[model samples]
Target: MSRRQRLMTLTRMLPSLLRILRRFRPYLRPQAPLLAGALLALLLSTAARLLEPWPLKLVIDRVVVATPSGGVSGIALIDALDPTTLLTLAAIALVGVIAVRGIASYFSTVGFALAGHRVLTEVRNDLYRHLQGLSLSFHDRAKTGELTLRIIGDIGMLKEVTVTAILPLLASSLVLVGMIAVMLWLNWQLALAALLPLPLLWLTTLHFGRRIQAVSREQRRREGAMAAKAAESMAAIRDIQALSLEKGFAESFCCEGNRDLREGVKAKRLAANLERTVDVLIGVASALVLWLGARLVLTGALTPGDLIVFLAYLKTAFRPVRELAKYTARLAKASAAGERVVDLLDEESDVQDRPDARPAPAFAGAVRFEQVTFAHTPGKPVLDRIDLALKPGERVAIVGPSGAGKSTLLSLLLRLHDPTEGRVLLDGVDIRTYRLASLRAQMSVVLSDSLLFAASIRDNIGYGAAGSDTGAEPGADEAAIIRAARLANAHDFIEALPNGYDTLVGERGVTLSSGQRQRIAIARAALRPSPILILDEPTTGLDRHNAQAVIQALEKLAQGRTVLMVTHDLDLAARADRILYLEAGRIREEGCHAELLAREGAYTALVRGRSGPPSPALSPAITRPIGADYAFGP
Candidate 1:
């Protein structure tokens, strides 16, 4: 893009950036008293700097120029001063001014930093909350490391702009303006000479600002890529080690890191060049001012004191121009960082609660699927034309081959993703008509890959029962937690841990075995005791021993609750009262174990492991006793 186009883009994005900053206005408000103090300090500091030159002018004009004699001895001149008294007063005034300036500057800096920190804290919190609310699809496609860098690294860049760049820019501008006004009052011609470098400085900044912004953006993008690579590699470190791909991954990371470093160095080089150019221009201007002021003094049109004062003001005025030129790079970096932060905040989730939706009333687990159909993508249905009902406390098992839509069926029941063509109803009410939180709260779900947070075992088990008094008193009751653990067959293992129930699980519970994590998840779900329960491959990744233990726990959990389990194990499916066979997104057949076998179709072939005529051993009567008393005996 052309330089002008780049600048235009930055200008266009400013309004949005400002709007984001406005969200932090409340944080800024509380610092008003500090801001006021800072402003006062800044004003005092500027006043003190302006006053320093006046004393020199006073000494030159009053003492030196007013000597009546053609020449006076140095001793006579010292005596003429009333010596100690005059010097003492001047020293006292100068010291007082310096003291005020120092104090003001200190307070101002503290105030600004506090405000910036407060704003950044809020921004980080909001970003994290928004990230949590985003749909799973977004996270599936997003890079973990890149998102982490944006939240930490990019946001840190913004803090530099707020605490350092912003205040310096403000204080310097004020000082520059004040100095220029004083110089103009002293001598307009000389002031014009001193001001000659400013236009060039401005031109230089305008020329390089867009370039710096481009380089900074490129650098940030590369950094994010590097972070993403590192994060991916770290997450799969075990796989990388097993495959011996560490060298390859390291080389890839180095390539990205080198790119970021190169872009960063390029920006720094350009900024340095710009600063050097400004310095040269200011030097030339200062020389010209001095030469002109000397000629004016020689012609008796100005005094030595006036020339000295003009030079002092000239230095002050050029200081901000020089500083601003240097800060252009920092400002560019901050703008890019702010843009990323704003992008995250601007994202709108696909799933949001309806405006007039009400919290769903407590349910008694009557779930119905009315011709529901869904697809992750167009023209590829995952669940199709399904109509089914669960009469309050029915125990149903879904059986199918891999990718047979069994898991999708259970997911739809929980409303993880809504049906595209039809509605799911609970107790005769459409699920979407109710608040999502309340709707989801009515069902308990357990997935094969159970995730655990870095918290005590007790906390993990009671995660779902937040804010409830399960046993007695508020908070998660220790007794109730233990009961739930015992029911899930997790009590024994948990008690064996170093801290028992209070033991902190490492990240994702990596310290525990897969079966242990699954049991804890089951215990969590059991604690919820929702009206409806859906288990998706809940017994997967477990050996025979653990599977049996889990199954026993599940039997207790399913007692009076409506249960729908999706599994591939025919043995587990046989335990359910009824089994539904799904094929190609539709329910092909559903019956008791013997009924499906009597048909001598898919289920029979699958069980016998052959395509020939069904064996007598696979006879329907043998597989299932039709008239036998099968209810659980007390």
Candidate 2:
């Protein structure tokens, strides 16, 4: 069992280590000089340590037991020196060697640590940038906590291997070779006895290496699961409390937390068990060498001092061997972490701009969808064979049942996902030909569940204003933000707050009411210099007063820009120049509101539901042709 496993140590650590090498290759190449310098320092430190043990051997033989006639000569000068004087010189030399070793080790570790930090930071930054650039579809399926673990926990473990384990492993390997060579020259029989337990030690390390790695990987995964559960519970704490679901959520969280704890305990037990076993094997090897060396000393094949040096060298030689086992264990786990980080970095994003895509010229707001079809999954169409054209500045309202693909229109318009078939064009050119940033710059959107960052109201508004300016950073256009807020009727409330626009809106705008958050979002959209506007249930959160005010403002804002609104309110839909009734993923009917109502189709049914008796309003007298400034009374 031991022999077969003896050579498996490298096999266990190799896979994860290889991944680390490949992922960090670009970052490491530029730091080769620093790495090389660290290696040199490690070598110097090892030399000093090896010399340290020899000084004692010299004192024991040439000075402490030097019978005036001299047992044997160490150096020409030391042979002539008196015992007391030689002992003093040897002690001083030992101190100097120790000092040199300390300095070298310090410099080597510091260099490696700095380099490791640099690489870790770069990896973190690159991972974050890539994650941000990934398509929404990817984020929809990937867990937030898993990605966070890769960024925070996994990379942190990798740094320990890179900075702490690497240099010691290199230096210890060299020292191991040099010490064994010296020990053999001193007494080949003692050297052989010293290495007798090496195979067993190697087998022990190999046996436990995989167990530790497997346990640690399981531990990290459980931790991620726990983190995700906690985040989810915290995010919905309000609902949980309101619905009296705290107990159930707490129980669920505890279940996951216990799972993570068990994983951690398993890993600790494996590591502790390996450590104890290695220590016992090491003791056995030392005992064997001691017994043999004593017999050889008594046989006059080796002197007492020679025996002492042999023992010292034996301990020194095996020191690295013992430490090597520990390092291999750590490296195994670090490799698992590296694998996770590499997996995330290597993940391909589904959305990417083509090399030949050019910056879109300013849009004229003329939008068209020609035979467009899209599906999140094959054969499960979200939009199918849609054909429509909206003249520049047309006000179009889209009404549909819950899954009739109303929201999907906004996604396609923003190029969040390309069509499964056909084309969407702006001004007769395919939108895919435009650079993403340029194309998005020409559109503004307001969704009911729009996200807000933990920032001041002014910064949130400026974030949108900045989008209108191609070269400016977000939150750089304060004046434009204020202007947009006034237009959205948000400026009065903003000023009424204690800190005005500078007040920090807590996480996800939780500090404000839903109505206030909605207004702020509307202001954000109003700040964009876009030729097209897309709103989904835009007035859902507003009170009647705010809704009416915003609707009035939107009516004015709608002029000279194509507006597409998705709403359940048929009254709002009736105000559009045209109403598009969508069902199942295809347009069923589209015409001026009065015209569609008169046809008694899907639009008529929706209007009838909201208007309750139809009130003779579907008659031709009410079928006036839609014109600019057209609106249905609130």
TM-score for each prediction? 0.86, 0.91
For each candidate, the alpha-carbon lDDT, in order, equals: 0.77, 0.78
Deviating ranges (above 4 Å) for candidate 1: 1-23, 26-37, 64-87, 300-302, 376-381, 401-415, 467-475, 599-634
Output candidate 2 Cα RMSD: 3.9
Residue by residue across 320-435, what tens digits does model 1's lDDT show? 77877788788888888888888887877665567888988878988889999988888899989999888888878887677888887877776667787888999998888887
Among these predictions, the greatest lDDT belongs to 2
Clashes of each: 0, 0
TM-score computed on alpha carbons, candidate 2: 0.91
**What lDDT score is found at residue 202 in candidate 1?**
72
lDDT of 2: 0.78
Error of 1 at 534 (Å): 2.6
- List model 2 lDDT by residue over 411-458, tens digit each: 888888888899999999999999888898889888876778998898
